[model samples]
Target: MGKKTTHKFKAEVSQLLDILVHSLYTNKEIFLRELISNASDALEKARFKTQASGETDELAPEIRVTVDADAKTLTVTDTGVGMTRDELMRNIGTIAHSGTAELAKLAEQGKESLDSLIGRFGVGFYSVYMVADEVTVTTKSMDADARPIVWTSDGRTDYKLQELDEDRPHGTEITVSLKEDLASQFTNEAHLKHVVKTHSNFINFPIYVGGERVNTIQALWREPKFQIKAEQYAEFYKFLTFDSEDPFDTLHTSVDAPVQFNALMFIPRHGNDPFGLGRENRGLDLYVRRVLIEKQNKDLLPEYLGFIKGVVDTEDLPLNISRETLQDNLLMRKISSTLVKQVLDHLAKMAKDDADRYNEFWRAHGELFKAGYMDFLNKDKFAGLVRFNSSSLDDDKGLTSLADYIARAKEDQKEIYYAYGPSREALALSPHLEVFRRKHVEVLYLFEPIDEFVMDALREYEGCALVSAEHADMAKLDKFESMEKEDKPEPLSDEQKTELDKLLARMKDVLGDAVTEVKASTRLSESPVCLANPDGNVTSSMDKIMRVMSKDTSIPKKILEINPDHALIRNMLAILEKDENDPFIDQAANQLYESALLLEGYLTDPHALVGRVQDLLTKSSSWYVASGK
Candidate 1:
């Protein structure tokens, strides 16, 4: 051992240390990940240098981790190009090389922004302080003339460097003295192995724990698709997701166009945390040149893709001075945009190539796709990837793609129609869809509430407008029919219709603003009444979601459409002739309006509905008893 000289950290180094020790990272465990990543990077650098020099010797490229329980020390060794004495002083003693100086300047200037600093700095080295009290780095350069060097830092205010004459090999080794509280956990071989296996199993080089090789899983994202076998992919999925079941869908894509990237994404077989659980966080692991940058990085993918678990590797990322912050590099944004497009394209192709398999994926992740449609409303690329069950198709059948729906549209069809209800059966049986079904118009069945917003956002596909079947303009669809005017009978007599208008006005007064306008239904068949929204501003689905979010129970107003041909409508018209003053008749009409509102999924006062129904039932029972006796 050589004589050690103590030195104060640079002005900026002191500032960076203060920030890092205070609140730089949210999780302390991430310190291990950062150290492992640095080891991997060093190993990669050594391998590249060796390959360039065409030297093949005893120094093989690998990363080895050793835990010493008795000493309370953990060491990560890498067979890479070690630093010389001057290099050690520059790389370890000074924070300039790591870009910490730049960050300090930014902080001083009050221009601190994670977006610009992340990826440029190499602060990942300091994360060791979070768990360790002292760190020592021993390195021997590849040059035979260069002597070994040791750099030591207690992470307080100073560090030391000196020349050493130990019989060290040509590589780097980092030893950390575990903090007293964490010493026991670090001493456990099993615990250390588990952490290595969980976070660094796919590292390109082998990682050994307790003198035993631990990392056996291959980095499949780095391998060519043709070289990867199905079993290998399955195993990789199982490892990446930590799931026993196989993935429902897997997309492995590599592109160089907008940005160079490699991605291996999988849709889980089960929907464990769907519905957002609060707000969904991004689950994709981000990497730069096969080295892990962040696990479950929230910025790599959109929030709607939280269900997807995968790895994305790119070489063009701009890491901050500490390699801790991920700065907003244009390259990263380009890569992100390209990745989203590629996933959407892959889904579209899968739906076309194998409908059955794609249906399974849709069943598991369809809600996420719907969410993407709602949140990324302007992302038509993602919108085109959505699939839905259609009333036009058979039950227990495959989903309808947006492109397929467009291809099957009639030449004169001005809109792509859709209907939302609780389920496929409910939508198909809805009186709202009766007119479209009669005209042989295919209506897409939307069972989920979010689907309404999705359809609204994707208003037009292939130049055809997306029209909800319950929209008031659906009445205009009748004009598109080739039926002659003489074929269909007039709705009602002019005088009876005039009287009916007066009746609707009186009912609207009783119902207050709840009824926008009560009109004769042109869309209903078996159902006595239904509701329609003429002003497309707010759909029933939006109302439902808002009500749940606000926890408010106030009912929204809606227009009532009474089917003229239905038996209930005929009876009400007859009752108006002899019983204009009958309280039972008024109760029945009001109940019919309220029932229509309920069926349409509008907000309604349930207590008022119950009272009206009871009154009508009592009046009918009394009339029956009076006539019989």
Candidate 2:
């Protein structure tokens, strides 16, 4: 053995290592990932060197991870370019090249603290100390005449280096003698294989653990789109999600503007947590050069887009010591914003080019994606992707985008109209749709509770306000001409108008503060009555959602709009004209109020409705028999 030399780690570097081994122990398994990643990097550099020198090496680039159970040692070996004595000292023996010194200086200046520097640099090699008490690295450089060297460290203050007499393979091998308590954890073949598969499975070169190839799955996202086949994407999707079914759609994007990243995102055919169980925590796997930094990184995409799965590999992100997560939130946001925009662009394309597929996507994901209205920064793009069943569509299964709705809408339409109910069948019977139907205007049907919140969050899109149907009383729908229906009813005469005004007054007195106002509705066409939002700020849908969230079943007061042309209202007016205080008058007014509640989906109990209908039925039957029909 040649003379050995010892080098000391700076105090701050020592503290940083302590932080890595102890403070960042949320996942102790990540130490294995870091070592594998280092070996992979070394192998990549070796490949580049051989290619750059125009020399073909006999051996293909490889990484082997092995554990010695009896020895309690874990070793990671790589066929790559190795470093010399001076190079090892510069790279491993000192903190100079590793940015530890600069980070410490920054800490001294109070720009950042020593504790905060835990994951801000790439000193991943030291992570081995988390599981190992001692580490030995043996290497022979690719240089023809270079001598082999051994670098050994206890990961305390100092490390020593010695020159070896005999030559070895021109690559590096790192062996870590596991700490007694951690030996069983890493020495177990299955656990080590799992750690490798989870983190470094996508390494360009092959990775073998315990002499069996473990990382056989390629990093499909890193490949160019032209090189990828549809079958490959499908297979990759299955491997990624463990789903037997192929993805509904795959978006392979390489974004450069705002930030640079390569993302292969899969929209599943369907989600397990369709009801949003654990939805907020779902995220994409974030990778730096195909080595996973964070699994299910929630910051990459909002919970609303949690249905989207797969990997995001970006060179733009900086990893901390453990590579457990990213260093900067702003950089993450930039990537996230770019990814979201790209996804929206793809969906818009899908909507245009592949209507059938896009419709299926809407049906499967609308409940999940509609919640994205809270991302107000991308409101316009999100609006274009939002799909809703419209009044113009024959069935609830039919959907229309806000852009499409606007395209088919009357030119004078200034607001994007929407309504909420149990189903398309229920919304079709809604009195609020009367005027929209007459004017041939489309109204979005919101079936889920979340869609109400979506409309409230996104108040407008592309210069048009998102108006809920409950607030149709406030919309400017009178300007458009009504569609020609057979035998359109005449306007009420002045005398009858005076009588109807009296009826509205009587209804207010009968219903009291239960209604904000009782007025003849210009928006109502077929249905006799419907409820409206007196406080436009809180539409009926918004209020309903709020109540449900609060677990409150109590219905609040709303505006009552009546159609004078409807037979029910006309009969009520006749009863009021003949006898102002008749007991039947109060029954008629209260019945209409409850009927409006039923139409608006706020009627929890049908007992009152049942009693009213029976009373009307009894009187109609008696009248029918007395008339000798």
Candidate 3:
């Protein structure tokens, strides 16, 4: 041992310490992850250097973590190219050159390669003091002539450095005297294992927890896409998602321009927490040069892609900057936006190139895309990636992209029409589709509630407007002429029709302003009555979402359209002619309107519906008794 010279922190370092201790980071547990990540980086660098130079006697690269529960101390040791006495003082004791500032300067100079600059910053080392009361660093550089060095700091305002005289092995060991409250975390093997697995599992070098190798999976992000085997991807998926089933799809890609990034994204076979009662999805993990920075980085991908789990490793990330408090940093924003675009493009390409695999992915996570389309309307890049089932395609029951729909549109069609309901069958049976179906116009059938909002936001695709089938003006569509030009079916004589209209006006008075209008509908073929929100004030899809969100079933008011060609309407008209005072006719008409509202997914009073059905059945029974008995 030599004389340990205690030195005060550099002015910049002392200020940085105050900020880190008081305001920089929000979560203290992040300190362990940061320190571990730094150690892993060092080990990886040493491995690479040894491979290149072939100078080291022991070429094995490994990171080992040991915990002393009784003494409340934790140590992380790595067989890496450690720092010399002078290097240790320069690297750990002072803020020599800020990594982020250097990156910015490099950007200005148009120099993009930052791979060798992984551990250049000194801030991450200080993070250990967040959880530990004292930290000791023992390091021996790869240079044979250099002496081993030991650095000590109590996380106050000063640190001490000395040259060690003991014949110690090469590499570095960091020991932390943990705070009392944080000791439990270090003592629990399970907790430490989870932290290591989450943050350092994909480190380029092996990581050992208690002398057992914990990181068995390779860092696929660092490898070439073609080099990855299927089993390797499956194992990585299992490690990332904790899923036993194989992933539906995986996108492995790297980009250098704008921002350097390496992403290995996997779409799981099933979504996270399907019932909606469990925790919200955490999105993807974020890494910087194989070190886990953010476990659940929602900013990396849109919320709709929560089903995707994988690792994104970037060497250019400013890790010292708080991701939570990141403001208008244009570089990070560009990186995030670029990543999202790349993901969307990858998905689109997959759907086009490998239809079968993309279909499987859509089956597992199509609703998430729909939800994203609605929530991230401003992200048109993602919106263009959305896919849904269309009434046009029969061979492909899976999904149809907006681009495909645009390509298949009619030559003269000005808009893309869509209808949303509970299911494909329900949408096929919808009365609103009669005119479009007859015209041979393909309508996109939306089964999810978010589809409406998606369409509303999209509004148009490739210069074509997205129009809903339920629009009142849609009834007057001239594209499809009636098959037969027979005169309109006469429901009642002119005088009688006028009298019925007057009666309906009186009924409207009784019903208050619950209806927009009562009109004879030409859109219906078999249905007696239907509701339309032509102006889309309270769209049927919106109503359904509100009901689902609120858990309420009360029906709202609507515009009722009666089909003049329907036998039920004609019979009611004749019944009123015989006796205008017949209350049964009024009840039947009201019941027909209520039934249409229900079919349209509007909220209605069930008691009123049941009472009307019971009354109608009783009337039929009485009529049968009067005629036969």
Candidate 4:
């Protein structure tokens, strides 16, 4: 047996102890969590030792925490790997074995904080000082020949180690003399049990608080998916997110090669902040060795997936000396990458297996998912996941994927076409989609403002360039033979074409720089006049959004396209040829341009158009009276 010995803590350890006692850990309650976690680790080490040594004695590894209000004492005992007197002196009394000397140096340099040192410095035992005035540890090594040892400290610069007189089992017990204020609450069995279940309930080993088993729920994420029942998954999801409804999607991911992690993530059916009044704090609860370390850690998933809730446990995470926060951002990014891929794969599978379910999910979260459309690395994947109302669909209830669009495209279709408007119904009524419908070409209906940005980022999908329906280059697209339209207008004769060219020139001269050009349209069917981008540049939807963002007042110049087959345009041309300078003729042409601008969403002043309509109405009434008289 060794004699009683007392020693002063190393200089760095003394400073570290000061930080732990006064400033370390945000919540004082975390001390219990840390202690329990350390006990679980010790039990795990012991179990492995028993396995390796082939010990015959049955080892029922367990952690027991007892609170005694009468004595103002809180005891945490674990049936696990115990330490010898030398180990106690080295591990607890000095900074030589504990990994906190660098932390102390960091604290000295003002680069580290007490909050940052709690979980990271391998000093979980010292956390007792946060709530305790004194701490004593009675421990006996797993070696049958070793004697029991007792260590005592007032959480100051010095500690005492002495040989224990009584014989005990191969385990460790730490007794903390709680401070006066904390003793009352901590000694209550219910409060202690709550703390145990809150943080360490998922520990593999049994945890008994006040002689009642507390860790009832196993870490289901660590279990194989086939073994877990559907009801269990639903219950787990409810527990994790606190939402009564089942998750829209569940992604269980386990990776071993790049980095070891077991993650079970759930896509929430609805966002907590439906109105988005405040930024929702969302992320996975990070766990290491089945013990909760960080809750709501946003770094585990990207911003687009903020609605995901779950647990991520990894043994390979390179935690900073304080296990409170992740040490490496690169490692976090890798984890995020893996999680995102798994989520995307799950969504893709859902899209394939059940269209209705996928559509429901899209209705709820599609807008949020658009945020990832610009991610260059995952643009292709996002494109496949995106769904939009297509001209080919009979109703707006169903949305078509890009792959479906590509698959159904005509053999000669060189580009994918899309139209942007406030809604599917509005887009279907667009003049831009006139020739597309005539040629039996499908056009995607982009409703949200972000839809344009998404399409812009996804300029091409599956080798087909995405072309806006309102662009002038669609004249070539008009040549595609259509089986749907039977009442096609005949091609204009050379003389009619010549006359149409003259009318276009006259309208262009009247409109001046307000438009780039005026031409007979091969794209329009019912509308008399519509505006288009002659340069095949920004679509009207994108133009409106950019103008709003930059607060630029200038309207983008557009090409005026007049449907030659329409009666209004034919009558305007006949009247203009007879009297090009006629006031009514000029009013008619300018009004047509304004109407096109309005349809293109470029008109800021409808008051001018209203006044022109009134003038036209008065003229028509006067003409009717003159004819009647």
Candidate 5:
């Protein structure tokens, strides 16, 4: 040492030191992360300068974390831009901000507020004091005129600054004399290596621990998309998620407007969880300038896009002084908005260019992504991306988008109709589909319970209201008649129509409050009866979900739509004509109501329906035997 002097720390810096050590930080291991980030930033600056000057700055930049257990010390050395005596005094010996009194109040307010540190200490270098009783820095500047100097501090009230005559390399070295309580955790080589891998693994420079490199994973998101190969992306994805298979689709996005961010996202072949459900709070790794700021940050993307897995690196996010939490929600929201648009744009492009691949993406992620109907700002885009099995399709394997359905829609049709059920086959059996089938209209088959919510959220798409088939207007649907003829019974005459009116009234009376109304329906062809919601404000799917959540097992009341043209209704009418108060008529009405309930999946008790079914079967068998063939 050539010369030595002592200096007192700024008033606010002393208070902030107390907060950093005792109050704010719950995880003490991150202090090493803060130190490493500062080192990385320094190295980046040196690298930029070398590029600007078109020459080597001194040495190839690298970060080395060395742990000394016996000596109770940990040292982090970085070959980057170093500081001079004056720079050290200004940066470390005193306050990094002006107005000490004002910042002192801010620091005092944060005594228990783990929120922010008003007194920032040179890009978070002060974090070292969390595990140390004293810290020593030895450095020589890249400027040849500057001499090697040393700054030692206890981080309490003051620090010691001295000049060195020995010729040290141009870089910065920080060694911490660990505090007694934190020595075992901070000075263990394995523990320090783990911390580096968790937080600073993507640092631009190489990091070595005990002669072995620790940060080997590349920050691939920052690279140009075209420059990388598919194999490289697969390797990175596997390393990120530990999944052996490659991704179904990869979205490599670099956005410059609203908020600048580079994101490389993946849609896994099977979701991150085995269930294939994507509506989760699972988030992506959030990095600021290539350094991990928050892992699995849930707010970066909406929960509907939870199936998307990858890293997001932004260069201009405002972070709290601790860098542990986001500071500005508005900036974050802007970034989120940009991410959503880019993702939707990419998906729409995928849909247009490669439909088979897009449908494969849907099979894997549609259940999760459908919940995005709540994203109204991009509802049109989301609607365009949705895929559903339809009535016109032969099986569930065949899927269609709303755009395709609309392209083939009838000229007079004004709504996009859908029917909800557990499977494609179940929806196909819905009585609401008869008219659509007759007129050759397409009806989307919605399977998941969440599909109801999606339809409700997205009330319309491209000028067409999304209407459930159960709530279809009979008067409007009757207009579009199919030209094909059926080989069925003749139309009813005036006298039979009068007889059917009495039968309808009788059936409604027997069912009591079980049905709101029992009326004739042209919407049914083969099916004898179907249930419809009378309220019109709620669809059957929505009502069923609400009833189930409330733990109400009772069957919901609904309007019964009877196909008078069907043989069952004609026979019932004839029986009513013979005897106005017949036992068979009452039994048949009750059975019809319960059967409708069963079709709607709301029937809680089926004993009565089963007994009626057996009675009718036995009577028909007796008639067949009595008739002698």
Candidate 6:
């Protein structure tokens, strides 16, 4: 062996390589991807040269990976534009030099084209050190007379280079002697083949592992949508998801202006159970020039759209800095914002073009989609896509979007009203909806756990504020213009009104701080009583939210509104007039308050309410016995 010259790696390179081998890459297997991607770039350069010069070489563009388990060595070879000794020293010896800059220089001489080159960050070749204890490279230039050269690195501080006497093929070959711990993983033929198929399966050049072709799946997103067929999309979706069912929606998007990218995304036939898989499991695969950089990369899309599965290939993305993470860069932000807009716009289109399909999607993924409702940048857009069961809807399965609700709203209505409950039946029976029903005003039924959060974040839709049905402000809403103007109930006689006021004071005294206020309510048309948060106090939804967050559980005081015209209240007045201290009246008053609390979903101790009801039942039984019935 000739005397090899030992040269130190660049200062920036040594530090960068240390980070890559120890910190930058989440998985050491990424070394294989980086090396293979570099090999693919060399092959692409070779193809471009041949095309530009109209000269052919005997070597076809191919990447071959061979693993020797016993020797604990992995080798990757590519038949592409090889480098001369000087070129090897300059390209691989130094770090952070743009490989594309060299190609650009060659283009100036009419010898190479920079358009097809895939690598810009020169440090990708150094990732081999992440898995390997040592790496060896052998290359000969595409020029027939060029001498072959060898470069070796231990990946720490220095690399060695030497010229070879023997003639070499026109390409580059890299051999990695993996560390003792990584031998079984990197040296096994099956494991190496799997890595190749996972990372470089869609590289334009064929990749062979263990003498078997591994990159069989084409990067279909790279193909124009016009040239692709429906069957092809179905086949690709099946291949991507492994689900037999067709995708609910497919968005094949390609953009070039802000940041170039091609995305083939699929809204699954069914939403992914993110909780089951861990939220981190949901994301799109990120690729650069058809080579997988990150698998299920969450940063590509917001968590709300995590149910979406697909591949996003962007040549403009600076994924070379770290195989483990794409830095939070402007380009990535641009891509993410663009992707979110595309998804929202696609959903909007689906809603407009086909109601049933959109409704089907909403039924399957509405909870997942609710995440976007809180995104202030697109709040209005997301508001138009929010779905709910409304009073006008026939059933729970029948959903109405905010836009539709607003469209069908009364001309004078200034707010969108919603009532929250555990189920549609429960919400339908809520006393808070009585006045709305009497006036024939629609009320959206919110049942999803996240529905409250969505409404809270989206305080308004269109030009109207979102108001809860239980809100005291509902009384101020414009009354139905066509509501029959029934004669107002005769004003209670002055003495009767005084008696009623005295009765309210007695009840308030009995309840103490439990009742914020006991007053007559016109909002109630059928129900005897209902609860409302004192104006400017925390709402019921806010109370529920605080409890869910493990915050204070103290019951918020509420105003107990009684329907003065109701028969129950009239009888209570007569009982109070005869005996203001009647024990039966006290029991009835407390029970009424508990019933209101139960309806409001604030009664935490149902056993106490049950006991109260039992006492009332016993009292009734004694009265019946006393009357000899």
Top model by lDDT, which number? Answer: 5
Clashes of each: 16, 2, 2, 5, 0, 0
lDDT of 2 by residue, 1-629 (tens): 78898878776567555554454354677777877777777788888889899998776789888889899998888888888888877777545444656655654544224323535544667767767789999988887787889999888778888999986888889999988988998899898888888888888888898999988887888889999999999999998888899899999988776777889999988755556474654688899888888788888888778889888998877777556546688999899888877788888899999888999988777777877878888787887788888888888678788778888878878789898888887877878787777777788988888888788787887788988776764448877877857344667889778889999998899999989899888777787787877776677777877887899988798888888998877777778778878788788888889987877778889898799889889998999999999
Residue 395 lDDT (model 1): 78
Off by over 4 Å in 2: 13-26, 56-59, 97-118, 255-260, 272-274, 278-281, 411-415, 457-465, 473-476, 484-498, 550-553, 572-577, 604-609
What are the lDDT scores of the predictions, listed in order? Answer: 0.74, 0.80, 0.72, 0.80, 0.82, 0.80
Candidate 1 lDDT tens digits, 202-284: 77888888888888878899899999888888899998877898887788988877778789998887665455462454468
Model 6 Cα lDDT, one tens digit per residue, 235-348: 998998888998878999999968999999998878766567646668898888898877888877888888888999998766543454564478888988999899999999
Encode model 4's per-residue lDDT on 509-547: one tens digit a residue. 888999998888877887888888766788888878888
Prediction 2 TM-score vs. true: 0.89
lDDT (Cα, 0-100) at 119 in candidate 2: 58
- My TM-score estimates for the predictions, one after another, are 0.81, 0.89, 0.78, 0.91, 0.94, 0.88
- By TM-score, who's the top model here? 5
Better of 1 and 4 by TM-score: 4
Candidate 2 displacement at residue 207 in angstroms? 2.2
lDDT of 3 by residue, 1-629 (tens): 78889989876566555544443234565666677777776777777777788765564777888888999998988878888888888888777665445545533433122211223453667767657788999999877787888899887799999988887767899999987878988767777888778667777777777878887877888999888898889888887777888887788889897888888888777766544842366667877777776667767776666776787777776654333332325756677777677677778788778877877777777776666655453456655667788888773366787777878866667777888877778887888887666666778888766778888777787787778878735634665565544445655678767755755664455455667777777677767777876467556787778778999866666777777667776767667667877786668767777777778766346789888899889989999999997
Worst 10 residues of 3 by lDDT: 110-119
Point out the higher-scoring one by lDDT: 2 or 5: 5
After superposing candidate 5 on the true structure, give the runs of residues whose Cα lies further than 4 Å from its correct spot: 51-55, 98-112, 118-123, 273-281
Model 3 TM-score on a 0 to 1 scale: 0.78
Model 5 residue pairs with clashes: none
